[model samples]
Structures are given as C-alpha cells and as structure tokens.
Target: MPTGSGANQATFAGELSVDGSTVSIRRDTDVASERVSVSLPAVVSVTDQTGEARYPAFKAIMGAKKKPIQTMSLADLGVDAAQVGWSGASSKVVDVSPTPARTAGTIVNDDGTGAAQLADFLAGRGFI
Candidate 1:
C-alpha cells in the first residue's frame, strides 16, 4: 500500500485506481481527503491522515525472525538477465545537469504598511 505522494505516483503509473480506492484525494486550491469503497483485487494506498501504525505482537515478530530467508536470481525466477536490471531498462539517462538557482523573494517586514504590502503581493501572485 502507498500513501500521499506515493499514492499519487501509483495513480499516475496505472498500478492503482486514480485517487485510490479507500483513500481518495480531491485537489482544488488545496488537498482534501475522502473515504471510498472499491472492488476487491485492487490496490489501496493510505495516507498519514488515515491512522497510526499497529506494530506486530512479540510472538509474531519472533515468528517472523525465525522464518527462513530465501534469495533467488533472475534465472531462478524464470526471468532473463537481459530482461531485467539496467541492461533491460527501457529508459536511458542521456545527460545530467544541476538545477537552476531560485530568484530571491520579496521580504515583508512587519512595518505599518506590511499588511498592505502583503495584500498587494498576494494579489500579484493570484493567491488572493
């Protein structure tokens, strides 16, 4: 399961339904959340807003630790080496460049005209 940004990315990847099933995100000027019931055999991504995590019990944890770890290669999984890893990757990085520096922002000091200046700034930015 994924959440928040992960959920959004999964939606873009077509892995999960757009906006998810259990957790739906509605965005206008800001983001809003809602509960939606979807069919089974579907992917559901959650967000921090959902709830806290429930840690496994000591017995379950001990059992998990006792479980054997199995490692397999692409050949063992019936996958071709050429069909996986960087060699099989569909995309290639042609070049890399540093990000452009950001311009300085207006600083609003708490002067008597600060409120007016802020309003003007907001209006100019279409955020008013």
Candidate 2:
C-alpha cells in the first residue's frame, strides 16, 4: 500500500451483508461502487471505518474467559513470515517531508471577453 487509499474512500465498506454460508464486501472506485460476494469460511479484513467500535460489557468480558480460544500462526494460514515482514521487503522508506504549498489559482472575470479568456487559459495549459 505504498500509495494508499489517500484520503478517499478507497476501500470503504459502504455496506455489509452476510448469510449462513456467504459474505459480501463493498468495493468502490472512481466510476462506481460494487458489492462483491464470496462463499463463507473466508479471511476478511476491513479498515477502522467499517463500523463504530463497541466496548465489551463486564458480563461479556467475564463470559469470554470461559470460552475456548483458537489461535493460528502464519504457517497454519499458509502465509510465509518473510513475505509480510520488513526484513523481506523490497523497498524501505528512508524519509518523509511536508508537502510543498500549492500556488493560488487564477481568477477569471466574467465580462464581454470571458469566453475568450477561458479559451486562452485552456490553451495556455495545453487543455485545448
């Protein structure tokens, strides 16, 4: 995710739908948003914006202690540790700096010559 979602709803879960044996995840793009469905028993990941977090009640917290806990490792999941760690990464970020300030945009005055001004502006920017 070198160039990440970048302030946009790159991977927003606009909505989620689940059934006994299937799941739905939202996919959004510049053109449209889509719902992708897959069979159940799958691995899924979502960002913080997926939904609001809820604190576990004291009773629920107590009950969790009585429940069985299952744990899996990278090998169990068929993922190689080296593939996901910085030690095996192909690139490292060496530095970060503040972005340069943007220049002010030109103002167009609408008068008898407004259209001509617009054409000139577009041509100057190679947009025409």
How large is the C-alpha RMSD of every model relative to the true structure? 8.5, 9.4
- lDDT string for model 2 (16-121, tens) is 6678877788866689878877665555556565788899999999999999989999999887898888967999999999999999987877988989998998
RMSD of 1: 8.5
**For every model shown, what is its TM-score relative to the native structure?**
0.48, 0.43
How does model 2 fare in lDDT? Answer: 0.74
Q: What is the C-alpha lDDT of each candidate?
A: 0.59, 0.74
Candidate 1 structure lDDT: 0.59
Candidate 2 segments whose C-alpha is farther than 4 A from its true place: 1-12, 47-50, 57-87, 100-128
Residue 38, model 1, lDDT: 45
Locate the minimum summed-lDDT window of 10 residues in model 2.
1-10
Clashing pairs in 2: none
